[model samples]
Target: VGVERTFPVHTPVIDEIKIITRGDVRRAKLYYLRELRGKKAKIKEKRDIRPGAKAAPAAKAAPAAPSEA
Candidate 1:
C-alpha cells in the first residue's frame, strides 16, 4: 500500500481511478486491513453477482467414510 504516483487530469486516467471491485461494502473505509496480517487481513466475503447469480454455501465438506475394518 506504499504506492505514490501522480497523473494529470488531461490524460485518460478513468480506468486508473475507477472502482474495479463492485463489493457491497457495509463500511466506508478498509484502512484497518493495513494493520492486520495473513488470515487476519481477510475481510468478510461478499456474494458474487451477475445476470444469473447464485450465492454459494459457506461450509466445509465432511470427511470421507472410513473403509471397512
Candidate 2:
C-alpha cells in the first residue's frame, strides 16, 4: 500500500498542450528512474511548451468582495 494524492496545477498559459514521448525506454527519468525497484517505476511523458500561447493574466487576482452585515 501507498499514499496517492492529486492536486490542481493552475498553469494559465496552457493553451495547446501536447504530450509527446521521446522514446519508449525502460528508464523513467531517461537517466536512472528506471533502475528503481517497485511499482513507482514508469517513464512519464514530457510536456512540450506550446508556441504562440499567451500566459494567463500576469496581474494578480483581485480580492474578493467584502461581506455586508
Best by TM-score: 1
Question: What are the per-residue Cα lDDT tens digits for candidate 2 across 1-69?
Answer: 555454445666555645445445654445465356575565556454675332542333556689999
Candidate 1 lDDT: 0.60
TM-score of 1: 0.38
Q: lDDT per prediction?
A: 0.60, 0.53
Segments of candidate 2 deviating more than 4 angstroms: 1-9, 20-22, 32-69
Q: Which residue pairs show backbone clashes in model 2?
A: none
lDDT of 1 by residue, 1-69 (tens): 556355785686455665444644567987776678787766665666564343333233446689998
Stretch of 10 with least lDDT, candidate 1: 52-61
Sliding window of 10 residues with minimal summed lDDT for model 2: 52-61
The prediction achieving the highest lDDT against the true structure is 1
**Backbone collisions counted per model:** 0, 0
